[model samples]
Target: MSTSYDCSQPEPRREGLAAASGAVRAGQLVVFPTDTVYGIGCDAFSSEAVRALLAAKGRGASMPASVLVGSWHTIDGLVSSVPQAARDLIEAFWPGGLSLVLPHAPSLSWELGDTRGTVMLRMPLHPVALELLREVGPMAQSSANRSGSPPATSMEQARTQLGEAVPVYLDGGPSGDPVPSTIVDLTAVEPRILREGAVTAAQITEALGHDVPVAG
Candidate 1:
């Protein structure tokens, strides 16, 4: 059984985070909290690790996990032709609950399912997650739940669902917001909201200084 680390306690949390980060570097799955919800993830560059993430989530090949990075430079490396509006949105809402789908860099060796030559990226607003990214580089992550099930908002819930598939769990208590991140697609001519969650269309529009489209 995996020992859950309570993030409220500094010493244990640090020790657990180090162990979790180690598991990630070893190509093992780790369940951790994000600003919006709990996520299960593995090294994005490890095809073996990512396949394990998919398997743990009981997800199909067509459904891909998003990549999380620690900084804008990492996003820049994975993305190309970043729209000006994208830059504006990144400045305003990144390091929080916003996800951007941009043109995938052709050089990335690992696959994220059938991405259709595109990738969704997020810079989460959590110290633990950011530290993990800094330690392990980008990670391939999905909500810590089996496909078609409700996403877990607490460490206990995530543990129930992911079980031994995730060897380490970082218990950051309950995520303050149960809502998922807002997904914005910049590959289109006009930036579009593929899925709306915590971030609203009005907020995105204001960030872009223009009206953005919403996919129906």
Candidate 2:
């Protein structure tokens, strides 16, 4: 069954953060809020938990999940390379809504969805998200809704969609951006837009370079 924890009280004290991370550490799923939308996440290293997350979404193995971290220092350990333009983008809009796809560490396990030598990484702007990630270290996270369904913008939506499958619902209220993050694949010869959500194509081109191909 699902448990709901409120995050209106702020970080650390917010029991939702603690409970969610606790669940993640134990290889269980927690539905939590992010800058863009709610996500059902688990410890990235836990292959079992990752499998469960995909199953919960009715997602296919070909669709990889993203990892959420608390800081830039944490990112280095997860990815193989963070290009200069990618770094510039992170410095500019991270802790906000932007997903950078970088080469994965050869040593990192890939059971967490498809991750095929690549990982979509983000440092959420919300206090609740950061607090949760800090406790869990890194989470294999994705939108808290079934695959092909509209992403949940609030805790209630997450609960409604996932129900008892999620161990805890970190209620951080509505997300700042109802849409998902703009996903840029830095692993490509030219940065490719896997998905365009919050960061506009114009904003990314200006930051990365005007020549970067805009995936329609």
Candidate 3:
């Protein structure tokens, strides 16, 4: 059976955090609210957990999953090198809805999917998510829904789709709008916008102090 917690309350929040942290460490999947939407996540270092996460969503490894962290400094250790534009963008939109795709440090021994030596990283602006992430380290996360379905905006919605595949659900209420984080590809010589969502192209340009190409 799966467990759900009402994170709006103090006692539940504490219990939920502990449960979710334990699940992640045990290479089990958990659902938590993010600034944009609810996400299904597992320990980033666990290939089995990541594979199960993708399988639960009826997804293939080609699409991969993004990694979420609790702090800005976490990127310094995950990626091979932090470019100036990455730092500027992080300072501007991190802890919000901006996902940056950067080259992963070659030494790390983890597989998210066919990431092509890269990983998309984000720091969500949600307390429950941040607390759990801080407690458990980086997590391989994707929107809490099956492929071709709408992303989950509430914990119940996530449970409806993911079911018992997710061992724990941290209910932080509705996750506001279902808009996803804007994805910016930082591996290129010039930054490129892969997907525009909560963040805008103009806002990204302003952050980098230069115009970036946006994929249509």
Candidate 4:
């Protein structure tokens, strides 16, 4: 059966992270709150745990999951390079609702499912997420919900949809906006907006102080 912990409540925050860390260490799936939305995560190094997470969400193994880190430094060697523009964007809007797809490092295992040699990466702006990432290290995560369904915005929704399949749901209250992150492929020549989400083209432009040509 799955466990729930209230991260907003001081007592449960510490215990929740400990439990979530234990779940990750045991190669079990965990549902946790991110800055953009709730995410289901597993130890990035464990293929078995990755498979379980995919099965829980009814997601195809072909779809690669994004890896969330405590900060850019934590994800440094995991990705090949962060484009200058992408670096500026991260400097401005990361730890918020932006996800960047950059070339993957050859040294890392491909279990995160980045068959295209790129990894979706983000540094969530939530204390719970930061603390959890710090404790458990980088985590392979995607929105916590059934594949093709609206992403869960609350721990209760994740619990109802995922049930006992997920090992733990770190309850940090309702996620804001109920929208996913803005995904951009920084590796592309013109940079492509893979998904129109919380961050808009105009907002990204504003953040960068220039009109970024976004591929369709």
lDDT of 4 by residue, 1-216 (tens): 778999888998889899999999999999999877789999987988888888888977698788888876876788777668787878888788888888888888758763588888889999999888988898989889999888899999888889999878899999978877888888776676788787898988887777765666
List residue ranges in candidate 1 displaced over 4 A. none
Candidate 1 per-residue lDDT over residues 123-208, each given as its tens digit: 99998888888988999999999888898999999999989988999998888758989999989888899999889999999988
Q: Pick the candidate with the highest lDDT.
A: 3
| Candidate 4 to truth, TM | 0.94
Q: Using lDDT as the measure, what is the rank order of every candidate, best first?
A: 3, 1, 4, 2
Clashes of 1: 0
Where is model 2 more than 4 Å wrong at Cα?
10-13
Error of 1 at 87 (Å): 0.9
Instruction: Give candidate 1's TM-score.
Output: 0.97
TM-score ranking, best first: 3, 1, 4, 2
lDDT (0 to 1) per candidate = 0.90, 0.84, 0.96, 0.85
Off by over 4 Å in 3: none
Residue 212, candidate 4: Cα error in Å is 2.0
Question: Which digits, one per residue and each the tens of the lDDT, describe model 2 over residues 4-96?
Answer: 877776553467777777788899999888888898899899888899999899888898788998988887888787778788888888888
Assess candidate 4 and give its lDDT. 0.85
Clash pairs, candidate 3, are: none
Tell me the lDDT of candidate 3.
0.96
In lDDT terms, how accurate is model 2? 0.84
Q: Give the TM-score of candidate 2.
A: 0.93
